[model samples]
Target: MHRDLHAVTFDCWGTLIYEPKREQGALARREIFRKCLQQHGVEVTEERASDALREVWLRHWREWQAGISSDATDMAGWGLEAFGIHERAAVERLGCELAEASLEQEVRALDGARETLEQLARREIRRALICDTGYSPGRVVRQLLQREGLLEFLEVLIFSNEAGVPKPNPRIFQAALDPLGVGPEQALHVGDLRRSDIAGAHGMGMRSVRIRWQNDDTSDLPDAHAVVDSHAQLRELLHLDGS
Candidate 1:
């Protein structure tokens, strides 16, 4: 049951990086939305802005579960609509600001993430990222990766916002594989979510490894082919430890 892995794909939010200040980022975004609304002469309380942001996130979650992708712009529009703010300029500014809000807060890569990716790169094993981005889009996530020195190690970056489809959808997986010229059988996807990452890669005929170093997803979905708690274990599993 040993298959050659030519390329390795990864999930962003939980597998590689942990958003320790996620709430702070959310609050920043909420404040950005509130100020944007005020500039448009549509005043709303912080509580109401927070509620709109929460509703938009809930909608995004629902869409993601159904394999649909919603980007920052989409969420921005939804947020404006929630408060009956139809100003085109406000939507544009809000989207731009909200997309960049996460940059204000720091994001940390899980232990061994950078080392694992660097080792994979040294071995010429192609790497790609298949991220299901939330309010922050692929551009922001790429910046975060670059800050952690992990972005250069990846060859292809496929974000659901850009692909128009999220993980658990075969198309997203194919999008990552097509650029690498690596088939599903020759690739291994590592992620934390059982529903999206595990199910998506498995359904695409790729081997999957679940990493629970950050968030341990206990969803009632199919389990991955292999499960590791950290990238050190992942290296051992992938025979990268000189075993």
Candidate 2:
């Protein structure tokens, strides 16, 4: 159980916020392919390109996950086989292909992140963001937080791409805490991913809370100090009233 929380750190995607689209299985492949081709001066319709991209993505998805290791780069070694595109320049161009996807304006605050943050801001607890890297850079992540009005309340926002280390590797977690001037035990991390956020936090002696919205698996979450269904519960975890 959590005794007291000095700071509340969070994961970005699928936790506090989400990509706009619902991640259509084949459609993701098609979108990637369409962008890859466009980057190479090839013009193709979305429908035609997606058919091939779907097959490529399917193959890569199976391969990538089948042999995934604790230290493997999440997106490495799947580019050429999965999308028939491996050029670094092309990959950069395809990064924002799904940029249009984001939570609707109404549900932008995942399960009470806004409310929880507001409550925490009034209390003594500090707040920070330790998020995984996606197609966008850390600046974009900060922009999203700002758009949601979360930036003003946070002490730091650590992104893997910016820090050059992924989570579950104590360094990234340390980077988040470095700016706060607090030790591990004083911080409480909240995220949806068990492997990266929860496990990583516990590894470093910080408390952890697992958010179960997209991830329903509780089998591997024994180390988490608490389980919250939404970001709103973050306030309660910090022992704050609605205020």
Candidate 3:
């Protein structure tokens, strides 16, 4: 599908990488969350961490889904405050200051991701990152990417904070395409969200691939140009192995 595409832009957090706060095994993230919660006099147990993380994320996700658009700057601050890190000391103790450095470690590329992307990039197909922002500022994100050695493989990086427009909006998609000097039809966007990536890229007239890494039932298949269950499947779908 869309083999003539000049570029393949991806959603960073989920499509090219796995960042599930509600999922377990994020030891570093657990430490960060625990530190933040404790500063506000809230205690998190091994049993309660999952519920708490999900509850907080669900509330924020609902706000966004309900079309309550807010600036990444303010929204992130609101999230922290709502999560009970209201005190100045709490914010400091929560490693907010070390957040930039911490993010470098957190931006782990998905398994088998690097070799695939390296092959894809070497083909002269431009690689771009189109991602949500708010949790970490754009500058910090850039730094993290650089630190993680991902920048060398990416041709362009677009963040909600930098674009001043959130996803599911055509403008954000356009912003990513504009700098690449390519029309929407010449590009393919891969993302994990039905509403945001599929609808948004579709609005911009770009081909879209939905990654089913989370196994969500709402496949967005009717609207998606393609659906991939794994990176291996994605490579096959792209005919990257000479299939």
Candidate with maximal lDDT = 1
Q: What are the lDDT figures for the candidates, one per model?
A: 0.88, 0.65, 0.68
Which candidate should be chosen as best, given TM-score against the real structure?
1
Clashing pairs in 3: none
Output the lDDT of residue 69, model 3: 42
Ranking by lDDT: 1, 3, 2
lDDT of 1 by residue, 113-151 (tens): 998898888788899999998878999999999998889
Candidate 3: C-alpha RMSD after superposition: 4.2
Predicted candidate 3 versus true structure: per-residue lDDT over 171-237, tens digit per residue? 7778778888899989998888888888888888899988877644385345588888877788888
Ranking by TM-score: 1, 2, 3
lDDT of 2 at 19: 47
RMSD (Å) of each candidate, 1 decimal = 1.5, 4.7, 4.2
lDDT of 1 at 14: 81
Q: Which residue pairs in candidate 2 have backbone atoms (N, alpha carbon, C) closer than 3 angstroms, thus clashing?
A: 20-101, 20-102, 111-232, 112-232
Query: For candidate 2, lDDT tens digit of each residue in 1-243?
Result: 446567778887777776444455236545655666666677777766755544544653454234222111223224433545567655544544433222222225565677777777788677788876643447666777788777788888887667776677788889889888889989888888777788889999998888887665556545577888866565566667645
